[model samples]
Target: MIVITAPTGNIGRHLLPLLLESAPAHGEELRVVVRDPARLPDAVRARVEVVTGSHGDAGVVDRAFEGADAVFWLVPPDATLAPDDAYLGFTRPAAKALAVHGVGHVVAVSALGRGTPVADRAGLVTASLAMDDLLAGTGAAYRALASPSFFENLLEEADSIRENGVFTDVVDGDRRAPLVAVADLAAVAAGLLLDRSWTGTDSVPVLGPQDLSPHDLARIMTEQFGRPVHYARQPLDELYTTLVGHGLHEAFVQGIVDMKRAKDEGLDAGATRTPDTATPTTFAQWCARTLKPAVLS
Candidate 1:
């Protein structure tokens, strides 16, 4: 059996459907650890064994990891806590459970810049890398999907794009870096979960087809929406202030600030885009399929 956590999230939503269609053919029984079973599609709820609770809960993970061969581990972001508490603390229980249950393979969602100098100081990314280490200590064959920003992140700015024909980021408009689609990340996770021949702890960089700058994204959005969309660079200080003003934990907000700073310093630029690392979806395609509809709607 393969256990999938956060099966209703952006990456998990896509991953669940792919596994649902394919796992049966491989003689794999599927299980999901979700907070609300009702959030799952009716058809999906009927197909998989559901362990209802927060995957971060020790009891929940103990129950879910039992009899599991592989696990797709995606930690949901918690802005109310500090970076280490949100990432590493959340995974500690599951790490123990994985060893106890002897779950051999694990595919986790993580950020880029593992070996880069910025990684150690990148706040949330640093916390996430530490979580990966904790899981690796369990002796599971772990693969952390080292990804850059997602094209879907732009969906959060749909209203701004629609109203002002602009999107915002903390990076310079000309700074190019790899960006991925959540679907691509999901597909990569599904592949690892299905084929467990690989062993040892390592990371797979899910870099998109090419590196794109904010200006390139603006150009693509303009083309896709037939509007004069533009890129607006937000000051890092302003971003931190705005997030903290929204009542997020001060340390958590600082983590966001630090992560943005690291990315600006080329934290995500360490990976080379080989065929193994490069995923198929382009920014333009993502805008057409995902962004355009959100902005237009």
Candidate 2:
């Protein structure tokens, strides 16, 4: 049996079908822990066993992990919570459940920067790494899908890009960093969850075809949309102020500010792309295929 959490999320939504399609050949039964079973597509609900409750709840995860062999773990972000509570606190229950259930393997969505200089101070990245440590301590063969900034993150600004031909971030406009598509990340996770050949704990960096800065993204956006798109670097203080104004906790807001600072300092700059690390999608390809459609819609 294979278990999945956050099945309605960006990566989970894409991953469900792939796992279901491959289940026959792999001889795996799929289960998911969802806050709302109704959010699951009718097809998915019909195929997989569902434990209806927040995965962070100990009772929910304990029930979901029963007789499960492999699990896909993802902590849904909550900006109103502290960094520790959002990452480690939420993961502790699942960690305990994994050990208790003796699950064979675990695949988790994490961030890159484990060995970087700024990793200790990288806020969310730091917390994610710590979460991995907690899971690794459980003795389940764990693979942390270490990804950089996701291409899907741009969708959050699709409307602004469509209206003003601009997108904003706190990172330096010219600092190139790895950007990956969530679909590629999900595909990789599905492949890992199905096969039990691998053992031990490791971080698998899922990088895009190439590294590109915000400025480069803007150039690609301009070409793709046939309009002059631009990149705007928001001041860190201003970004923090805005996040706070939106009712985010100060600790959570600071964590984001620190993460952006780390990125600007080249936190995700160390990973060298290889056949294994490099995924197939490129910024230009994603922009044309995904972002354009999102903007148009």
Every candidate's lDDT: 0.95, 0.93
- How far in Å is the alpha carbon of 89 misplaced in model 1? 0.7
Tens-place lDDT digits, model 2, residues 21-97: 99879889999999889999898899999999999999999999989999999999999898989999999999999
TM-score for model 1? 0.99
Top TM-score model: 1
Worst 10 residues of 1 by lDDT: 284-293
Writing each residue's lDDT as its tens digit, candidate 1 over 1-297 gives 999999999999999999999999999999999999999989999999999999999999999999999999999999999999999989999999999999999999998999998999898899999988998899999999999999999998999999999999999899999999999999999999999999999999999999999999999888889889999999999999999999999999999899999999999999999999999999998889888999999
Residue 162 Cα positional deviation in candidate 1, in Å, after optimal superposition: 0.7
Measured on C-alpha atoms, candidate 2 has an lDDT of: 0.93
- Candidate 2 worst ten-residue window by lDDT: 35-44
